[model samples]
Target: MTRHVSTRRAATAAGTAIVAAALIGAGLTTASAAPTAEKTPGASPTKLSASQRAELLRDADAEKARTAKELGLSSAEKLVVRDVVKDRDGSVHTRYERTYDGLPVLGGDLVVHETKSRRTEGVTKAHAGDLKVDTARAKAAPKGARAVVWAASGTPRLAYEKVVKSTKKDGTPSRLHVVTDARSGKKIFQWDDIRTGAGHTQYSGDVELGTKQESSGFSLTDTGRGDHKTYDLGGGTSGQGTLVAGDDDEWGDGTPANKETAAADAHYGAALTWDYYKNVHGRDGIKGDGVGAYSRVHYGNNYVNAFWDDSCFCMTYGDGEGNAKPLTSIDVAAHEMTHGVTSHTAGLIYSGESGGLNEATSDIFGSAVEFSANNKEDVGDYLIGEKIDIRGDGTPLRYMDKPSKDGKSKDSWYRGIGQIDVHYSSGVANHFFYLLSEGSGAKEINGVKYDSPTADGKPVTGIGRDKAEKIWFKALTTYMTSNTDYAKARTATLDAAKDLYGADSAEYKGVDAAWAGVNVKAAKGKNKH
Candidate 1:
């Protein structure tokens, strides 16, 4: 149930495990380092000439090879340089994507940290240990074998399943793993491999994007943000779709008169969200890994919804109503990308209270990203889906200050709150975040009015959005787990606040008060800061 990439899951589904095993014997490593040149932060990444970027990548590749050898990576493993980030202090962090036995390894990525003098400081591995699993007898399941997936911790292994009848619910198969002490048959691991969780268009006004330079010209692929690419679905619902290619890199005219306008908005949103995480939280990208997830626009005819699919590791959006209004707004794009972040960290299952927390996390960061952009055309607000107008009315889909304004969303937590739909239950946490950042009662920010109230009628003081965002992000990445509930969330944020602002700081007090405002109590006996 842990949220992570699973290469074996896909291999098992495709019956390619055997072939992958064969390829593992001849694995090769490629790593290069960038030139030891100092670059400032304000230097425009897009302004780098094609030749300059090529030279940088070439150096990075060499560094990757050296790093893999230093790490003692076996021939069954390969390291692919994903990004090489150089700090002003001359330190560098080189991120890599890993493959095992020529197949993608789910939790095998790592980052090599170097000092200003280019000395290897150490490495941060996503998962440790050599991937040496026996797959000779790992055959595809036969018909009616009762397929069950096995996902091991750190390193996952795939094996065929065999069902056994036992005492359980009627028509329900027994959930058990077959094991043997003999070396020939040992159930190394067993768990469900299915992972599910739950972007863009022309609505956003004049914005900037990171695009890819091509031989024909530039395309809508963002090299700065983990190489995220945007594609036009062409009104279809399947496949990776077609890449949005054009001769000129400059896209969109600030109006829906051209379809590229929507594409531009989506691309811009992705870039903004990427920058928000990198600058604010020191995260490389969604999943804290350099790999980028793509966006698919123009999905279906007048499709009004946008969703993040973990299966494809991409975000899909539908043009709304007349196909002219694309759903790719700044906040919406951030919201979807934050879902990917949640999947990698905390991994709140998209059901029950955890599901509600998952949704609210997206809403929280989505608002942060909007404010971070400081775009004049789309001023930041505490309203969700305000630009999309999915409701037809001028009102936003969800109100953080007063979530109950949506009629269906809850303003505060209560018993059986988990029984409610995740989207509605998310209102409680959204209200808590608003109260934490803006306090209770009426206030105005960026020309938007908000009147947040407490369930206990106790006034809560504001801590500002910047501090609140850091606390939440810290809790998500450091404290939360896959099944964190509301009460647990209260503890997590409190711990996060203490870690960032100290136990006696006002920021810590605000986190506790905000949860109380939402009727969530910190668990007794839990560490209090």
Candidate 2:
């Protein structure tokens, strides 16, 4: 069953922040670079100078000592501290370290690098990207066991953090994982497991138990910093929000060896995506009605990608092998969740033009979510999949202005282009949405700069977001059905604009102009694929 707990300060102000992307095309060209985030989506990225680094390093070490004491750590444990990234969004963070309290009461050691967002302190991630808290309680001795956790660069502060579970000499972590809100210091999600018997011993061999060595410097997404990976992090939260449960769909095993790292990576992305929708669009859940979707990490056998299953209302991600990594980034999560939202509201057909529209809608909202979160670890940009890189070129998977840049999408929406994989075909709609929301010529909105353009030589105009979203939602739910085609989508959306935004509202004009910018029209000409 789902649980809904309120701590404090819940408001609807998000309605004002997040709107659909339908900016009018600027009619300009993109820059040579694939678009630098300028900032991570959550907190601002703070690069420390040599002198500053020394100071931060000192403070980090001291902080570790204080935290160890607070957690009742012993002297045999040695802890290492690092600064939590300060994203461009100016969020509150609680950075921790990986250390042991002398030797374990049992025969091992306790070390962790757990960081979390300080929501009670109002430490929100600007990019709406989630904050990852890395904590561990592994072995410290040379032969007994040792677990190493590398600090991910872009983590935000954790709030209302408490140890929900721990393993006694019995060897079971009956309970593990804690959950809290970023805006208010409330215990929205928590669990406490008491181990009763010896845990699985074979896991030690598969996980390099006593021989575990420290590995570092794995960037999660794009940005020169932020986005890290963990071999072991055990702990989880409710819903797909934090899938550390070691299910068939999960990518990693949430054991004492690796629970914290996995939880940090998965939950950071999920929470950030959640906040993006809630704070920006006033959406309650995937359907704007307060439903939480499950996010399963460590999916399948060495799976290499992440996917949103509309049928299951869940997202599954892999650990990536043979050069393939999990696509579970903030934008990626947003892309997947938006699918659920679209399925619920628009039910756009998954084939042909409507399919492309549906797919693009996911990309559109995903990017917007990144922008809304505005973190320093992961900034909002018009690029996709720059984090996982499935490609080794150190570039993103797709570009908004020129979908063809990815060598997969049609620059313009041709009538019959829907046969392609929805991932690729989504380019047409992605470009159109960007143009609609961030209308033409370069300028800064929410501290991020975006420049868009029209298909033809003409300059386009945009309808404001509030009206645009209402119109889009109306079109999807009221007029269109599962089999709706692109042509039908156009008609339905226009009709929707007229009904709610007024036949002459700029929103109405925008729907027309947006379609016009994409070369989508009523006629059955060459514009027809």
Candidate 3:
């Protein structure tokens, strides 16, 4: 079974369709470019004095110290700042985004704009009409952009460079400033904008583009290698990762120990996902570590959905009582396991746009894994969770070709798209993957008919999943983060294609065209496509 964000099966026991029949759904999360944020560079800020500026610098230094205290750096991580120009606009708005000790943040590429617009009366203080102050120049975000992601994480605080404001020729009658934390979307400072001599002026911060964050836990070298090690959780042994099953009542308990016989049906399914990645992607462990992640059989008593927890780094299983046998699925295993890999690598958050991309990334690679495994036990195909009969009628969970047909997923990106469940939100990337790998058309594999159309319903020929897998893998390793979503995913992958296939190479062109087919315009940055 394909382990995607959701387990789409027949609705029997409080079943969720992943995409509701009436909900009608969504796509790749673009970052928000609007004024939903507090203290946007173009937004107002907290007023400050020359003394305050000095204090702010002091505060930044203090932050540096705090970070060092909390996250001790290898001499390498202590000073590395991997900040580079990102986003549609080239350092276009906010002064600059910076990373402390090389920790990666979403704002490293986003330029923030905080401006104050106001009017003030001089000592003359006469009711002024034309003498009044107002904003004149308007700066727009760079063109060919998709969405803007603005958010705050519990960890990762946002830092600003310098603050600016508007004032009169002599001085300001009133003043304003805006301060924000780029990493966490937290507002640092703000103030008023008043007129003195200059009618209206906009202020900005010094762009200290943020660098990348160092790894927080368990490094790649931390885990051992190969079948040399057997994983023992509480019960038994699993060579690396395993897929176990349970009775209708007790679903995947994997117990790390076995209770009843390890369900062959469940074992085979999980094995497909495990061996697929190992044989196809050459990924020994989900994180490329030799450490084995145990797959517990029968997760819950008649459980409905399967999931991955970073804390455990393993995929769990579930039984579909009455109408579902989700444990006996291939894509589901791959989908869940990939979540482990993502947790280790990009570590995208599980909410909002980042959540959607996180889910989609799992599905994309899961589908690719299915393609690579080509196992006769679980024949490799594009259909997600084809083995699990949620409907009890033998129909699979979700379809990769026309996700919308499943009634839970959206085929394209649109406004208010983030509202859908991440499982459904995955459509944008799922569709993009379909476009990249197979293009748009009705192709039959394993007798599964897949007819996928581009965003505009136009047909797009693809580069096939084999190459697509490599390119996407490269992107995940080189350009993504815990916060990356669909738009960023596309950008990262396009950039990856060029890196792996050579600039302007056929492979790169194929990737660019694939995104275009999905209606995502090619962008720059690591975004080569």
The C-alpha RMSD of each candidate to the native structure, in angstroms, is 13.4, 21.7, 22.4
lDDT of 3 by residue, 261-310 (tens): 22333333345555665555445566454455655544444444555544
Worst 10 residues of 2 by lDDT: 18-27
Q: Pick the candidate with the highest TM-score.
A: 1
Off by over 4 Å in 3: 1-270, 323-326, 523-529
Q: Which residue ranges in model 2 land beyond 4 Å of their true spot? A: 1-259, 278-282, 287-289, 321-325, 441-453, 463-471, 523-529
Model 3 RMSD, rounded to 1 decimal: 22.4
Give candidate 1 misplaced runs (Cα > 4 Å). Answer: 1-201, 526-529
State how far residue 258 of model 2 sits from its true place (Å).
Answer: 5.5
lDDT of 1 by residue, 111-204 (tens): 5555555566555444444667554444444453432222223335544454343422211112333422123345543311112111123555
Better of 1 and 2 by lDDT: 1
All candidates in order of TM-score, best leading = 1, 3, 2
Give me the overall lDDT of model 2. Answer: 0.45
Of the candidates numbered 1 and 3, which has the greater lDDT value? 1
Per-residue error at 267 for model 3, in Å? 4.1
Tell me which of candidates 1 and 3 scores higher on TM-score: 1
